[model samples]
Target chain A: MDRRSFLRTSAVVAAGIAAIAAGLAPLRDLKNFESVEEFLQKHYKELTPEEMKQALERISREVERQYGLRPHVRDLKPMDGVEFAYALNLTRCIGCRKCVHACVAENNQSRNPEIQYIRVLKMPNGTLDMEKGDHNYATESVPEKGFFYMPVQCHQCHNPPCVKVCPVEATWQESDGITVIDYDWCIGCRYCEAACPYWARRFNFTEPSIPRDQVNPNMAYLGNRPRHQGVMEKCHFCIQRTREGKYPACLEVCPTGARKFGNVLDPNSEISQILKNKRVFVLKEEVGTLPRFFYYFDV
Target chain B: MIKNYFRFLLRCARIALVGDWRYHLWLGWLAVICLLGLNAWCKQLVHGLIITGMSDQVSWGVYIANFTFLVGVAAAAVMLVIPVYVYKNKELHDLVIFGELLAVSAIIMCLLFVTVDLGRPDRFWHMIPVIGKFNFPGSMLSWDVIVLNGYLILNLHICGYLLYTQYQGRAPSKWFYIPFVFVGIVWAVSIHTVTAFLYVGLGGRPFWNSAIVGPRFLASAFTAGPALIILALQIIRRTTDYHVTDRALLTLRSIVQVSMLVNVFLLLNEVFKEFYTGDLHASSARYLFLGLHGHHALVPWIWTAIAFNLISMTLLLLPLSRSLRWLDLACVLAIVGIWIEKGMGLVVPGFVPTPLGELVEYTPTLNETLICLGIWAFGLMCYTIFLRMSVPILQGKLSKANETPGEINRVCPAIQSRTATST
Candidate 1:
């Protein structure tokens, strides 16, 4: 090469190196890297029984290392012959927002930039219009005047728009009618987040900053397991508890017996009775999500 | 055959590397911007998308907005392709390659914008074909992934084949490229249509659930895409010895004129429907055009874009735009106008009122803006480099016969005109 051409080539090389060097500066802040096991982990459905066991063990170790909490994590599968459903008594709900806090605690949601799945919209009595509902009704409130509380979470829709929009099969409807997300598998594109009419999905924008003591020990792989900085989490109907035959954290914590949860398949279940007896309606029925969750009024 | 291809690539790389001070400066400026973007992306990776203006409320923001617009730009290559291949317009025969090159760069930018928008970019392989669980056909996003990557490859093949054949000083095989060129024209339309489908298929976001989105996307893309080409062609004519005719510019102007009119009409149609009905579903549209419940972050943006669009349309329609200066101004206005209209104006409003009837305004952070600008700079740099190499090949200066680097720089006017006319 001539002197002029050699200078040009050298200049190109120097600029590239400098650019790469400058680009690498901010990477010092990066604290997380996928472990080999985590990186090579199979999809939720594709995971064999033994691979799943090992994966669960790795998660337990990681959680212990991070929080000093040796949590009891499990891959809670749906029960056969059971399809879960929820019903809420809008008249009985007082809009206290205890269920919101209870959900956060149970779900291991981020505390710093708060991620709450349940939004108890305080709607005016005059109209059932969701547009009229106030999400930020700040007062010493217990069913203020003509306003009634309607708590909304993931409907776990039969025709889930969120599931349909997921570019990867990161989220899917379980056989029991609950929509579950494989947190590990989610690409965090958040297409599912945009597709949900109910605003049910939540994304972890940063590392979840849960208090050490506050970390719930009983975790489900698909539910309350601690999420990394950049994955989605939402109300999975408290999969850790519900699949084990316990009521959801929100349902259990409600002061008014407004929240109801049971197997819709069982004729004697409270949800089944409510479905038969009450004047029930699903939110945004026009959107055609066909939610497993329903709202009812005691007129 | 492989050795000859490698030799062609090396010559191209050398041509790209060795340029005048102005070229060095332009490349340097773009490099700095790309590095700035890379720095911002690294920070985003570290801190997560918390650094961005996006929240659970406004799930997607600036990145997706830019992604949407760049997809349109990539699809706009069809405007030139139609005239050249389908209509057999001789004026645009030589210029269509530039459009294809621009598409290649624009698609690269689109992919970058999508990558930066992703929250868990580390898990990107999860969407890959076999190893990953790709939710094809079911997900519009999966369809987007396929169409976009496919379009990129199609344009690359068409551009690369044409340029490499030119370097070999041989007539390009009609069988090899002609079929692909026709496929590319349909593929271009499909790319933008699929991107529109990504928004329109979402029944939850009423703002994006209109039937007009698909058509509006195409209309705006054709307008903006050709407008960009007009500006680029002018720049090429002024800077390089590349022959860009007034007739070619006029043809592009006409394409821009018709598409701009349709784009403006579609906007008006959407505005009338939203404001007339004034229902709850029109909350997002209200938020865009007029402040809904006194929170209109996008009112100024939408109005500004509309003004630009109207002014550009009027200029393009008028005989005054026959002059190059007025035409250039109109093109710039159209590009900026459509960038705002198609990018932030479309993407942000869809998430403004949000599905839950909550009002959370989205404003891009400094980091986000830098990343966006960086991708644009990177794209321009790529286009510049592509042009730098291809212009020489087109002029018969860099070819198999003129193998020596010294001889490649010598202007052969006789060979240049013959090569130009033959192609």
Candidate 2:
């Protein structure tokens, strides 16, 4: 092509991009509508009861049309008033894996026989236990021993490293101190998986292996929805259930009442009382993770 | 004459199949079957990573280790290139193309290994575009992508120009030769350094956070890469009419001797920092070399690596071994031992007791092993095709290279349009 035509074509492409940028950048300051922040910041859960019911119906219809199957989709998940917190009694945890099972059923994770959010480690008590723990342990029985349980999951750190390392900005911390992942946006690079000191992040290697009847009907859009293959997922502090003032199933089912769930900000809440009466601590204090969940000896 | 023509046709077919066509074909078929096996593993995409031997406890595994090893192979080829192309050593000059081609193959393998380790492959394009997803500036991921892609382009450009000139029966342009030499050296160093940065900057993994990691990687890469090139050349020497003198081979041995010495010295420096003080930081190396909690899995492999390196260094260092026929055999042994030792021995031990204080053993899955073999076969296949394409150019027989770079710029229809468009 001639130079004049080449220059003209290049200018036309540049103008097309400029037009799109002009349209979107000023849409933030819409006088005809509300502000972009005002539009986006309205928590989906804060919608009117009628609006939430409409969303549920829309999603159920969409799922059936797309998958040729009906998936339970409900948005009774209220978010205006309630907050979530979790506390663990260090002295009571026996590494029974019951909490792990309770999480699988309650959170509606795939019954692949191995997936679990909580990992109770048989950490050696006292001595220089600097760097020795087994992650791939297949010991079926919880042996009676001089071992302390270090229940590990996402710390929901105030300065979360996983969030900073995400190339796609797919993971973020919320106002309620819960860290959540955008399952659709996550590329499964596992850079965050490496960045996390806690090893809490898990990758979807294939489609989740849930039987059709067992799949959870009530789903959160960004929280615990059936994740796509090759994305990262982790504990979201059971955000979907906790947003509605309901206890996480794992906390509800704990036989020893070992788990305590409440809001940390409320001075009169059970976790706040537990923090005052008991010497509670978060793991990896040296790394400055500032964990929301705490473990205490005599809560 | 007809019989000769048929024989020539058969040889070309074999050349298309690459070296030891029957053997290469057998391995190639085996690799194809392994892709079917990968389908079974692919079923775990959503089942969560629970499908693999890897768990929340043993978060990273065989995939990462192979990534590290393949990077070493890619970086190693520069050892051959720099001496020949930059220094213009007459003995090594003719062999530089082989190194460049070898590097191109290794880089492709490195990329494939990284892909295999991903939780999802469909979202790979998330790293592309001039926009949102692939955070380029501050990320080690961006550094990896840039340096790797840049080196591949640089080498292919150099490879094509060299062949093109030889085909046209012309001496190479001063313009092409000068820039290629400068970039070749930088490109050689960049592959391993970027790979080292992947681990070294991670402050959490105590095993990988050493400052000397970059230097150590380069030292191993330079030594092993040349050893691989030399071994490959020896096979080509036996099978084909291409020939190099004994003295030229001896010069290569000396380069390896110096490289191995530097590599071992660096290892000693790393070991000294780990053991000099009785600190807890010293334990990761100790755990790898001596069994931690009585698990001595990597011991035999590391020891064999040490022995082969020592034997190869001895032969290279000694004047008598340089002349001995068995010296070549020793070189082959050292190269194989180092490839395994670097690939598994370095990678697995570094992550043994992970940052979370989890010690999970890693044995490559059968699919991972088979796919790795397939990658190697594919690389060899590429080499054969490249050589067939390259041989005529190298021997000064192609039509394209007769014109000067300036002449091609002036008269070529494509170049005229490109320059006109720029105007």
Candidate 3:
């Protein structure tokens, strides 16, 4: 490498290390290379929470040292007592893009102008017709022309086709049912992106387009902040927020109260009540996505 | 000794790459410069996919299509390599080594495109440290990574070893040849199979979930990739002392012609499966072919692809066109035309209308398109350079192999006389 190139590479490494450190970067385990073979028998989930934390600390420090970037190594322990669930209303939805915008803002998504999660489709209510739906219409009025609104997000499927297609174990469903991605671990193969039935995942084609002032400071290393270009990302049920007992920003901001999110296993929860009283259906249920989002018809 | 070797190599390289190579070397250098410039553009960091015209509705764009196309380009080499290496078609076997070099370069392009398509190119390494957070088994993703990278390594090892022996003016050892042949066949088929699985394996996307997708990819790869090789070899023959004969070129075209026939058959088979079954999944196919869902944008392009392929095959199958330069040009056009047809026309439009029924069109950003062109140019550049470097080695081996048949005969009489006198 030329001196100029070397300096540039060093600067990049340093910036990366700095970003990682700020992100609560994981610790590196490079010192125990000799034990790699013996360690192969151990699965990461078997590690105690404390052990995982320590491992993350090493990962953070090592990323700092190697690339001069402080890569955030968030606590990999499944959110304590976390359960996966979602709900949707077919009758009330107007196909307005409120949920999509809410996801971007609440998730601190990049405004630097790239594809983000959350899409609103205006579907004609009576016909088995998709082509009749116009995504490009700028009138922005909804629930018109005998049309129904369907909001699509990560289905949090029990049998996610996206998870099954990842070449690198970059993204997978947590035991609690939330699909998580190792942002740093993904090789950007896009296999998972292509296989996703929901079009739920988004790749950062570039650094996020968010302005510095608009950047959400309370970012989780794994969940939000500045995503690098190329790796795939999708909704993680906002574990960074929800795990601490906060409602997802999208749910909190819903104008129509169309979205209901909670633990499916909780019988006493409002979602459970809604499920019992209403005829709820999933989108493309025949395809067996088992979407966490359920639709209820209003009489 | 190392100094002496370097000095000798300098002398050889000067002889090999200078004078007549001036134009090619300059062109290659231009490609290198373009690649460097593209790196700088990407280095600025894409903020999001919004840089490209891909909206939430149209998530995939040119990079993906290129990846799909390049997989065929990468796998194409094996289609050419296998018949020659395994079947012992002496005519095609002579160019097998060159085909392998092309395969290696194509894989590099494929990987590069996949890298540029991600959201976090930096975090890409996280997948490496075994059992990262979301390790899902029974995923086509796991298969894609394994086959693509595995085939790449397989080609590298096979090509590298063969090139080394050829450089020493000797045939690769017989032991290596048989395994190499098997790997070539399996790897060629696997490359396309894994790529097709990326699409067809999806459940929600009714258009992609078909059993016939993999075979279609393989058949088309064989047709388009080898046709390109034959054209490239002809170019080489004209510009340099690289001697591809009429008979060898004819044999290559024959392979190209036969594969194109299969390629068309696969297309028909796919159409039949969807149109005949009249299943719900058929809707997406209908949208693409007949523009049922108001995505009529791709109709003309798709039909043009079909027409070009048919006409190209007609020209190829006829002896008059086969021997004619104009027919060869038409074949080249058909090959490229199919590449675009399969890559964009077939691949992306299948999923354009999201399941919830919203249509978004994908228009590639300048950065994305430039990067695609740069990588493609780089692949071609790599192949050209490899040919420049390795062809001499291959020719030297051919010279020796050519003489060896007579050489044994010349030695046999002398040995026989000596044995008789001793008796």
TM-score of each: 0.96, 0.77, 0.79
Which digits, one per residue and each the tens of the lDDT, describe model 1 over residues B161-261? 99999999999999989999999999999999999999999999999999999999999999999999999999899879888899999999999999999
Worst 10 residues of 1 chain A by lDDT: A27-36
Which ranges of candidate 2 are over 4 A from the true structure? A1-87, A92-96, A123-147, A164-169, A245-247, A255-278, A288-290, B1-56, B59-61, B275-284, B324-326, B354-356, B399-423
Q: What is the TM-score of chain A alone in each candidate?
A: 0.96, 0.73, 0.74
Residue B307, candidate 2: Cα error in Å is 2.0
Off by over 4 Å in 3: A1-82, A94-102, A112-117, A134-145, A187-189, A209-231, A255-257, B1-16, B19-33, B36-50, B129-137, B169-171, B275-287, B290-295, B324-327, B397-423
The Cα error of candidate 1 at residue A264, in Å, is 0.6
DockQ of each candidate relative to the true complex: 0.82, 0.21, 0.30
CA shift of A55, model 1, Å: 0.3
Report every candidate's CA lDDT.
0.91, 0.66, 0.68
How far does residue B284 in candidate 1 sit from its true spot (Å)?
0.7
Cα deviation in Å at residue B226, candidate 3? 1.9
Root-mean-square deviation per candidate:
4.4, 11.9, 9.9
How would you encode candidate 2's per-residue C-alpha lDDT over B134-251 as one tens digit per residue? Answer: 5555567667877888877777888766765565456779797668757867876887898788777665566677898889888777777777777777765665557656666776
Q: What TM-score does candidate 3 reach?
A: 0.79
Flag the better candidate by DockQ, 1 or 3.
1
| Ordering by TM-score | 1, 3, 2
